[model samples]
Target: MILADLQSRLRIALTNTLVEEWTLFTPTTGTSRPSARTIAFHLGWYLRQTVERTWSVDSEYDRSGMVLEQAVQFDGDTRHVPDLIVHQRGLLGPEHNLLLAHVSVDEASGPDDVPELSSAQALQRRFGYRYAMLLDLRLHVEGRRASVTPYWQWATLEKGAESPEPVAVYTPRVLAEITERARRAGD
Candidate 1:
């Protein structure tokens, strides 16, 4: 499958689930907000949906239990687990034939975390994944209504780069464009 096609599908799934579906759910607490694990589950679910929709064959996605072992400059070697991982059908191992997504939910008033990006870059460099996306969801809640804005960064081994740069802030229109482009390319 084409990498761009898969990426476009992922972008749409994330935008719809986070920006649209998440806001409608009522929070349990008056002040407390969704945690990183909560957001990770949602993102993982959407990623699974995208994989199922795009591929005809079987595939596997995990929210946990998969680790990318990397050798850091001073840390010797450490294991890093991404929020979501996608593996091709029947080939299940710690190999690099997988797609990865790392998620961070930033405070409403705070900037997107830099460490997340750095870690993602390190993973890309070590694993040489075909594609890796860093998703930072900035959340703000007013009274009972929640607002979420998503930022995306993508890394590809084709570029031969250690790190990825900020790509686009996700929106409904952007998702629509991606869908249309994929459709056109298919035709």
Candidate 2:
């Protein structure tokens, strides 16, 4: 599948899984919420499950062994570590065998988190990966109630550019459409 299509499908799968399978909030003394690491783990798990369930078995797309804090080198010298890297199965190394670099974000994330996205995008440009995705799980705490909103941003490599441009925003309606499409395709 193409990059956009894969991104759309994955977004749908993640949103649905988050809404249906998981509870977002737990009671705590002072505005407790899910940490970025916890969110990342759930995202990775659901992403792998969705890919396995929806994609064709013959496609040979393996979402296993998603590494965390993987150090990658580019430009012959510079090295950067990203939060998570998803690549095809049987790839020899991660330097050039990345399918997507997922940057996780939460309420505490800020400008410091941006460099990771840039680094992932740079790697995508150098290696011609389909896209890089940022998965932001924003939590809002009010009194005793907590709410979470999930945002998906896709960066696609633009022609002749060194880094990717924000190509699409995966909103709820788009995600719903993609989910329905995936269901129909599976049937």
Candidate 3:
């Protein structure tokens, strides 16, 4: 399929998940449940970030490049879509190996990878997330305005675990800043 077509299909899959099974995205443990838009934005942000990292090896596409293969659920069932997936293969069906990927950023870290946060020690050093960014098929959703949705940060995940006990949420203002920069650039 053409790149545009593939992207459209993938988004369709994301929407389908939100409409039919977003409830399944519950923390599986926590009492708080983020909105669908938040989830979508989280997934979208994760995907965009992955493409950026992958672009180092596959220069054919930019950091934001991805074939766009959408679906709900970790297995495209119930109600769960992962945040991101690697766009390795050309525009086609699921990869022979895998497509979806998960990601998380540690807001508490410094540029030097210093131990700004407890999870900093475990991050991929440069781009690795503080928590497990599992690639669930149901990830990736649109948020308020034109932004990626929010993502779930499981307490069991390292980011939360390593964090200083309780009230662990990383709302990176960096994305909003980037969005503003992009908007200004386009303007």
Candidate 4:
């Protein structure tokens, strides 16, 4: 798929997840930061609906059966499992590895602190994915309520480039509107 089309579909999936899965951002109980995996699961569900049915959308799927020599080590493991991936299940090449995404929720870290961006780049280089993205959702918990703001950056490795280009899923104004909608829904 083309970059613009993929980006458009991603935006729809994110918007749907933010609006429909608002509860995941705000818990009625203790105010703990939301889980990145949990949010990615929801986002994957929506993304699956938007993408072509032939592509399988999965999370933490590391059973591709291919040897990753240059894979980044994390948490004492050499295997790199992306938070989300879109690809054909049996094939393991650039033609099949369409996209890979690393998801995170951080309240104190800046974009520079996001190590997932590096992981994304490594996975894209190793797996030869056409696109790799880092979805960093910033969440703040105040008492029983929480607020979330989403940001994303992507790299188009189709041309064998290593640098990732930052992309905004939502403009500042639209992001504020989405946050307000979630807050009102929670209230």
Of the candidates shown, which would achieve the greatest TM-score relative to the real structure? 4
Ranking by TM-score: 4, 1, 2, 3
**Candidate 1, TM-score vs. the true structure?**
0.63
- Give candidate 1 regions above 4 Å deviation: 23-30, 52-80, 89-96, 108-116, 160-165, 171-187
Q: Clash number for model 4?
A: 0
Tell me the alpha-carbon RMSD of every candidate. 7.8, 8.0, 15.6, 3.2
lDDT by residue (55-79, candidate 2, tens digit) is 2211113344453234333222443
How many angstroms is residue 177 displaced in model 4 relative to the true structure, after the best TM-score fit? 2.3
Name the lDDT value of residue 25 in candidate 2: 39
Candidate with maximal lDDT: 4
Query: Model 3 compared with the native: what TM-score?
Result: 0.23
Off by over 4 Å in 3: 26-187
Q: Return the TM-score for each candidate structure.
A: 0.63, 0.58, 0.23, 0.82
Error of 4 at 26 (Å): 1.3
Segments of candidate 4 deviating more than 4 angstroms: 27-29, 65-70, 74-80, 108-113, 159-167
Please report, as a residue range, the 10-residue window in candidate 2 with the lowest summed lDDT.
53-62
lDDT (Cα, tens digit) per residue for candidate 4, span 57-127: 99866765555554444322444467799998878787888888877777464554455556666778876
Clashing pairs in model 1? none
Candidate 2 pairs with clashing backbones: none
Better of 1 and 4 by lDDT: 4
- Per-candidate Cα lDDT values, in order, are 0.54, 0.50, 0.32, 0.75
For candidate 4, give the lDDT: 0.75
Q: Distance from true position, residue 119, model 2, in Å?
A: 2.4
